[model samples]
Every structure is written in structure tokens, then in C-alpha cells.
Target: MIPLAGWLLAGGSLASDPAPTQSDFGGAGLWQTPTARMAEEGELSFTANRTRPYSRYNVTMQPLPWLEGSFRYIAVTNRPYGQPSLSGDQSYKDKSIDLKLRLREESRYLPEIAVGGRDLGGTGHFGSEYFVASKRFGPVDASLGLAWGYMGNRGDISNPFSIFGSRFDRRPGRDELPDTGGEFNSATYFRGAPAFFGGISYRLPSRPLVFKLEYEGNDYRSEPHDNDQAQRFPVNLGVVYRIRPHLDLSVALERGNTAMFGLTLHTNVARRSEPAKVLDPPPAVRESAAGRGADTAQVDWEAVSRALEDNAGIRVSRISRRDAELFVTGEQTRYFYPAKGVGRAARIVGNEVGGDIDWFTWVSTREALPVAETSVELSRFDALLAHDIDLDEFRRGVERNPPLPRREHVLYRADPPRFSGGWSLGYSQNIGGPDAFILYQVSAGYQAEYRFRPDLWWSGALNANLLNNYDKFRYTAPSRLPRVRTLVREYLTDSRITMPQFQLTASRRLGTDWYGLAYAGMLESMYGGVGAEVLYRPFGERWAVGADLNWVRQRGFGQDFSFRDYEVATGHVTGYFDTRYRGINVAVSAGRYLAGDWGATFDVSRVFANGARMGAYATFTNVSSRDFGEGSFDKGIYLSIPFDLLQPRSTVNRARFVWAPLIRDGGARLSKRYTLYTLTEDRDGDLFHDNLDRIAD
Candidate 1:
């Protein structure tokens, strides 16, 4: 049987297999062992499973073709990490991370092969490592593999690696108690006695249902906390029902006595449902251009600015005309797509000015910093408006140039207190911790922005608590470092109405590719700071660099503008890269964190054509594991959904949700309101090309 391991690896299956569906364990699996199946790229899945002694919640994503990543929280029903007298009845909840890599795809003659590690980080309560293979025949899919560590605790057979040394006969025991739990314990991997686990899944004919049967691997003798469970039979049976295209439900009878149930919700970030749009009518094409008696010199530039705002979604700061070219310097205010906004503004220019105006130049600006200059020829505009023209060809004819070094002329300028506001209802929660099993808050907030100048603005937000259970947030994880964070209860319970942000920001365009900003006031819920940032981004480039420095004082516990004595100077030198592969973007930053710890952070996100984004980030600092406490480093996942995905009209607003396992002091970065990379996203050539279908709007 030990030699069979080598033979199995050399043998091949006879048919190609389809991708596997998620099993009760959240990844592609049958029962206890994972199968050689991978989810579609950009797929995000949330799964919940419950059995006798454990409940698991998983967030899984397939960011690449051969990789699957899952972050999970497991709750042990009968085990408590804290005494009941102090922390109320709470089950021990542990956070674990898992990853699987596919080595070979199923072909006509070979089975799909994969290797994976479960519970790779955190306490090794249920950790295991395995190599598995699967093949499909008609509606029946079969999987088989050998598992080590906790999965093979039954010791049904001798360790195959023992041939190398007797030390490989027994797996090393994990430290029962560790100061921090996020480190991977690699010494014990593949060192234990191995056991066999296999299963078969059958799909019901023409029905959205699947049945599975598997042989157990573990004997349940080494359960956490010495609470070993009883295994009456070694076989397990299960069934899964597809409730909807994005939803699934599963149930299983395990060990002849225990029952398990699971629910999964899945979505693909790369695809979205197109909504019916009620769009503004396109600008009317000029009929007999010579008949419209419009004087270029006598045009009401102020009213023309107002017309541009109302019709074209462009807020003109200054307008100038030199020779046959009319230049409008402004910011985009409405359309989410920059090209659509520029095209609309150009059409408005052709309609307001006479045909003698040979060119319309749009100077795209942010905080009065010129980002790019777009020149549209009147001839190309007329042809696109009247004739059947390819938008790409027409755009090629339009000139995209760097901003001019000097201002040509100032024909008109307008300064007004532009007021804009909106309100949203939000809910936040913390789960799977020794604190309360769940602490949550529901709040409603309103934000208002007043633009005093093209480069200066004031903004503030006030949130009113509608409902909350923050009083239950009493338990705080132990930490040895300065408490830069982990004071959630103090901050959440300080006031019913809290102002998270109120600031005045001034920005300037230092050069065509350089921009700068200075901001001060209450920056966030816990910090009040003055900061400055500078960025250098070339037009239509794949990479850029930036640096930001801030001097911040902690806010008072009352959630007011008063400052605390705790202050820090922190900043990062960051680089941004567009991989130009599957719309992936990567950012790397290295700097001193809020806790005075030096560290680096890596972030990778995917932006769909519709502007929806999904990403995850991880940070590691110089702080020792003992000082950092549980979750040795900071890590989280986030999703940014565009408002237009649900609304009938397009807008620049987005609803963002982020989740971090533990809020420790090791690697905390300042959460600034804006960044130059985001502000100048439109300057990317791919963005304009992706949204060219909206050129007419």
C-alpha cells in the first residue's frame, strides 16, 4: 500500500472532468479531503457550516486560475477559551487561513491533481496537509487521497516517509499555548502516520442536487481541549441542493450519528447585471452649422460654465480662448466615466460656440492640479455626431496631450461655495472573538462637502447611532505594545452622535505630473491630524510613486475634537502598479505605523469594467509576536461596489465594506479620506478604452 502511493501518482484517468462544486468544508471537497477542483477566477464565496461541536464561517476567493484562498472562523461549541464567570457563556472561536494550489488539470487521460494546507495559520487545532486527485465519469465524480497531521490521527497505517528516518514516524506536537497564533508551524507537516480518505459525488439527473459518500480519515481521538469525540462508523453521507444560481444548501450525516448543514452564497466580481438606465439625451447635432448665428467673443462664459455643469457634468473653473481653440479648465463632477464626461462637454462646446471654433480643449484638473489635457477637433466631432463613425477611430483623431507649461489666458473665473451632501445607513460588527460572540452597531450618517475653491475644500460627517450593543464589547485582547488601537468599547460608547471626520484640504498642481495636498482638522474617528502628500504620476502610465507624511494626535474619548497626549509622526513611501493582467492592480507601501513599528503592506485588487473592486491586504511589522498578541499581523478583505450597479443612473459614489480579523497595534495605517491614485484614475488609458461605449453620453 505504501508503494501504491507512487503508482497512483504515475497512473492517469481516462476522461476530462469539470470544475468541482464547494463541499461542506467551504472549498472544493467531498467530505474531509479536498478534491482537485478550482473555482472560477474572480469568484467570491461565503460559506457557513455547522455540525455537532463546531461551526465554521468561510470567506473564499479564487483570484487566480490555480489558486484558492479561504479565511475561516471556527467556533467550538463545548470549549471555552475564557471562564464563564468573567466573560459569559461564549464558545471558543479560532481564525484560520487555508490555501490550495492545483498542480494539474484533468485531461482525457489524467486526473486533476492538487496540494493544499488547512489551518495553515493560527492555533493548529485542526491543521492538516494533503495531496489529492479527482476524476469525473458522467454524473459521478470520484476523489481519493492520503492526509497527514490532524486528518490522519487515526494512525491506520505507518508513515511512508519513515523510510528516510525514524523521526518521520511521529508528527511533532504543536505548542498548546502560544503568545501569538498566526505563525505557521511547518516542522510537523507530513511527519505523521498517514491515512486514506476518498469519496464519490453523484449528481441527480436533471436536478439541482448532489449526493456524496466518503470514508472517514480521522479517528476523532485528538480533539482540541481533550474533548475527544466518538466515531461510530467510518463512512459519511451527504447531499447538496442548489437553491439559486448564487446560493446552495447542503446536509450530511457523519459518523452515523452527527448531522451537518451548510449554506453558501457565491458571486462573480468579474460580471454584473446590467440595469436599465434613464440617461440624459445626447447633445443635439447642429443642422446647417453656418445658420446658427452665435458670436464666439460675446458668449456668456459664466452662463456657459453653468450650462456645462448642468448638461455636461463638468464644473468649469476658468475659460480661455486663444486663436481657433477654446480651453475650459475644470473638474469632472457627474459622470463616472471620464471619457463620457469629456465627450459630452465637447458636444456642448460645439453647440454653444460657432463652427469657426476649430478646437475645444478640456484641461482635466483635481484640486487645480492639471492631470491631463484633451483636445477635440470640431471636424471629428461633427463627423462622429452626424456620420456612422467608429468611436475608437474618432478618439484616435482627438489629441490627448500633456498639460501646457503656462496658462494661456484667463477669460472668465467663477468662485462659489459648492455644497454637496448625502446620507447612508451602515452596520458594523465584530465576530469570532473572546470578547462578545458578536458586537454590532447600526448607524445613520450624513456627509457634506463645501468646495471653496477649485483646489481647496471643507468636508464633515456626523453619525447618529440608531441601535448598538457596544456595552457587550468589554473583553480586550492582551497586548504588550502601546495601545494605538484596540480601544473599540471606549470609542463606540463615548457618544450617541459622533463626528468621524471634519477637515479642510488644500491641493495644488505642482506640475503636469506632480500634485500636492495639505489637510488638517479631525481626520478620522480616533485621530486628528495635519498631513501632506505628494504624488508623481505620468499620464497613461502603468506605474506611479507617492509619499505622505502626517503628524497626528489621538482624539479625546468623548468623540470630540479635543486631542489626547498620544501623538505620532507616520508616513509611507508607496508604489502603485497596474499589472495589465485581468484588471489586477498592486500596491506596496513601507513605512512607520501608528504604533511606531516599522512595516510593509502588500495590497492586490481587481477592478471590473463596471468599476466594482474586490481586494485583500496583509501587513507585517517589526513588533514581536508576543507584543502583537493574537493575529500576529494585520490582514483584511474589502469590497468596493459602485452605486451604478444598483441605481438607474451613473455616479462616482461607492459603498465600501472591509473586514479585519483582529484590530491590533502592530501594523495600523492612517485612513486618509482621499489619495491621488484614486483622484486621477481617469488618466489611465485603459479606463477610457474600457468605457468607450458611453462616448456619446
Candidate 2:
């Protein structure tokens, strides 16, 4: 019977767990602890829960089918990190990272099984390890688990692994004054007596509510900071109300005395609204080219170029005719899908050129260097557009070929304006540390650009602070390494208005698959630098590689084009891989950092179809954990959300948010403004093929 149950569970014969019916502290569960349930893939949630001495703000994401990760900040009102200073009142706030892995899915006669670690990275004051299983029958769900460390403080049973050695009988205490916080405290994990906990949840019929009851294992007498309290009852009770599809409210009674309240906001990043197109009508397809005449005059070619740019969003550099084929060289902008730009250009060409033109070839170029060429039969294209025919037939005829050698008979060339400017409002923030909980600023900036040619340009930005609280940013972490990034207070408080960036950039395509870029300027908030990068990305390939080099001088606190004495040279060789699994991408960079530390960084992210990207990265340098200061290393999570998701019209703009536990000097990179790989992304055909339906627009 046991073997049969195992086979069923392995095959995932049972329905997946439903959405959270009750809050589990700050995640998905019943009351005080998590269940064996996992959230849906691509789910992003923010949860805030409070009860007496503890309040937790958590950001969680299910980036894969069998994995869940969360970053949390817990504020302990009863304790403070240290005596108050100019940094403002100090509260005992702890930053923790958690993860869970699913082992087996539930079946008709079996429960889902998972293993998890909480407070895995931090001071380890509330660290715990557990293995849990859950199952559902009708409207009721039940879970059971065994826990160790703080969760097993009751010490109800003997040490489970004591048979191996006497050292496994007791958990080791954590470092009380460590320089860093993210080091894994393995010696203290699952090394003590174990305890059991269980819970049950029931859904109410005809109502958007769920009731929960749980038996907690921790006795609360072993809490950190000598802030322990008595637990009158082992059971916890709670209820959750689903206020809307994206919101939930929960309240719980725990320890038979304290009341807990939680609110959760969640959304699926993979789901997005349909494309919001403009009201302009699509270009009309001509039935025949009978009346069109071939005029290779320079004026005629200029008119054709204007038609392509105004109607099709293609900026033409040159146009020529050779025998029965028409060749146009240009760059594509404005459309998310290159196929749409190509299709629109084809229709406009057929409308202007004579019937003798049998083929239309477009040479896609970036920075005046041709990358790829696509050829289409003008006769077949017109037929597909004018009649009811399979669009696939037209797609099959489209050919991606190498660029042809230079043609001699150019009819027209464009010379565009050299200057443009705009104004925008932007915001920046720092969060989650012993320093003030958050330091933020809102500013308005005017940006201007001058183009020397297609491959060279100059850009600058001047900012005025409209609102800020930088005077409150006083705390700085202690570190043995050079203070490459910890002088935030001096930088922000120097001036209310500043010039964050001003640079001149030059870029060019070196070969069919190689691109290069060079720039010099005040690159970012803290430094002015000169850098160059080269990338080799083949069309439609899953992997690419690039290298970069930079020489920089630290900027003065005034942030007005003045340099300090500090100088450094840093660079990296980076590789990128697209897994092709749910839009996951992995990048690894190895090089020297700003503080002269050598290391590698690993980043993984998933980009949804709607252009929303969620990712995390971690850096490990040669510096020891203690020397690296808080966080042990450099790590953070970021989200880039497309503006189109909130706007009524489609746009390519995005807003980015980043959260880091601490800012240190060990593994920091120069923040360059642009890269060649992103500039030439449309050279690949996959993105265009994925959105073929937009070709008409």
C-alpha cells in the first residue's frame, strides 16, 4: 500500500493546492508556520503582518514550479539595535532570506511533501528548519510537520541524529556580533531535539472566507534578545477574507492572547492585457503595380524614405535599385515587433515602385553597419494582403539571409538633426537597514542629446531635488575593505540639485555578429569613468558572451563634474544564456570590482510575455565574510515593470525597483548607461516571429 501511494504521489494524481485561505505569518499558510503548499509559478506577492513585538514585511515570488523564495524585514518594536544617534531612533530590524523546495505532489491517498529553511541568512536569531506534508479532502485542508532549532524549543523528543555523534545533541549558538549576516549557519541547523506541529483549514460555503486552527511547536521561552514571553495555549486560530481577486485580509488569535492581522496583495506577472493599438488605420495594400512608374531620381527616393519613416517606423539611410530587386538600408524603431515594421515597409514600397520590381530586400543596420537582410516577393505579399489567404504562407516565404556586399547605385542618403531634449520626473530609494528604514528622493530632470552622426552622440542630465530626506541618512556599516559605496550620506547631503550623468558615446557594428561601444563621462551617482565593451551575439542563438573594461575616478560629494583622489580600473567578462524555459535567463560575470576585489556574480531572471522582468543576483569576492560586512556578500532582487501594463496605450517604457539589505564595498560594478547587446536586440528573428499577429499594425 505504501509503494502504491508513492507511485500515485510521484505521478501528481491529486489536484494542486488552492490559493491561500489563511495567512501564515507573512506567507501562504494557516497561522504561525508554512504548509507544504506552493504558490503558482510567476506569482508575485507582498505581505505585511503584525502581532505585538513583531511586524514583518515580505516580498515573495514563485519563479519556478518547485521553488519558492522570499526576502523579509522584521521590525521588533520591543528592542533596539543600539543607543539613538544622529541617524534617528534605532529599532531592532532583522533582514532574512527564506527558500522552500517541493519534493512530492499530493495524490488521492498521499500528501504533498516539502522541505524549507527560514531565517537562513541573517544573525540566526529566529532560524529554523522543517519538513512538512499537506493534503486536502473536500473543503478541508490539513498539514503536519517536524521542526528543529527555534521552532523546536519545546525539546519534546530526543535529538533525532544523536546516533551519529554526541555533537549532534545540541545546536550551536550564532555569532552575536558578526561583521556579515548572510553566511549559512549550518552547524546550528537541525542539530537539536525535534517537535511536531499541525494545522487544519476549512472553507466556508457560500462565503469568501476560510477558518483555520493550528498547534504550534515553539514554546517562546528561547527567543532572542531576552524578550521571551509565556504561551498560555499551544493552538492558534484564524480566518481570511478574500476582498478581491488581488487582495486578502486575515486576522489570527495566537498564544491565546495576542491578535495578529495581515494583508496580502498579489498578481500574476505572466498575465497581461491585450495590446492597445492606436486608432490610425493600417496601410492599404495595392492590388497591382500597373500605374506605378520607376523613377530613380534623388527627389523621388527622398519621398519614399519619408513614407517609410512616417507610416512604417523605419528610418532609412539609403535606397537603391539593382536589376529586378529594390534594396533599402535602415534602422527599425517604435515597434516592439520587427515583423510589423517589415510588413509595413513592404506595403509602402509596393505602392511606390513599378511592377518590374520583383523582389524587395531590407538590410537591417545598427550604427550604419548592416546586420541581417530579409527578402520578400512583392507579388506574393500584395496577394496575401488583398485576399483571404494563410498568413503562414507569407511567413514561410520570408527569408533571413546574410547582408549583401556593398551596392554601388545609391539614390538617396539622409542627414538628420543633431540635437533634442526632454524633461521627466524620477525617484530613487534605499531601504532595509539599521539606518533609517527608508531613505528616498523625488526629482525632476532635463535631459538633452546631440548626435554627431548615427554612431556617435552626446547626452547630459541635470536634476533638481523636489523632495528628499537625505539628512536622516547617517548610519554606515563597519567594514575592513575600502569604502567604495558606503558614503551615501555625504553624497546625498552635499547639494539639493546635481548633475548625475553627462557623457559622449560612440558605437559601431564590427562584424555580422560582433558589436562595440565606447563612452566617457560622469557615468553614475558616485563616479566618472571611461569604458569600452564588445559583444558577440549570433542571430537566433541561446548563448552570448561579452567583455568590458573601465577606468574611473570617484566623484566629489557635490556631484558637479569634480573628481576626488580615488581611482580604479575594473572590468568583467560576462556570459549570458537563455534557458528557453518560461523565459528564464542566466548571466554570470567574472572580474575585478571597484574596491580592487576580484569575484564573480551570478544572476537569474524570468521575463514575462508582457515585458515584466523579475530577477536576483549575488556576488562573491575574495574578501572574507567578516571583511565584507553585513550581508556577507552583495545580493539583491529587482523588478522591471512595463508602463503599458498600467497605461491605456502600448509603450516601451519601464519602471525599475531594487532592494538590497546593505550597501558595502567588496563587489561593486560601475553602472554604465548602455550596452551593445540591448541596442541590437532586433537583429535576432525570434522576437519578431513570436508576435506575428501584430504584423498588420
Which whole-number lDDT from 0 to 100 does residue 446 have in model 2?
93
Off by over 4 Å in 2: 1-25, 159-167, 176-179, 274-312, 319-332, 337-395, 399-411, 683-686
For model 1, residues 32-137, the per-residue Cα lDDT tens digits are: 6678888777566777889889888777777777888877788888988598764688888877778899999999878999998888876777888888889989
Model 2 / residue 245 / CA error / Å: 1.1
TM-score of each: 0.89, 0.89
In model 1, the Cα lDDT at residue 183 comes to 73
lDDT (Cα atoms) of all candidates against the true structure = 0.78, 0.77
Cα shift from native, residue 253, model 2 (Å): 1.6
lDDT of 1 at 399: 73
Kindly report which residue stretches of model 1 are placed more than 4 angstroms away from their true locations once superposed.
1-20, 155-169, 278-295, 298-304, 319-328, 357-361, 374-387, 390-395, 398-400, 406-412
Flag clash pairs in model 2: none
Task: Give the range where candidate 1 is weakest over 10 consecutive residues by summed lDDT.
Answer: 1-10
Residue-level error in angstroms, candidate 1, position 378:
6.2
Query: What shift in Å separates residue 85 of candidate 1 from its native position after superposition?
Result: 4.2
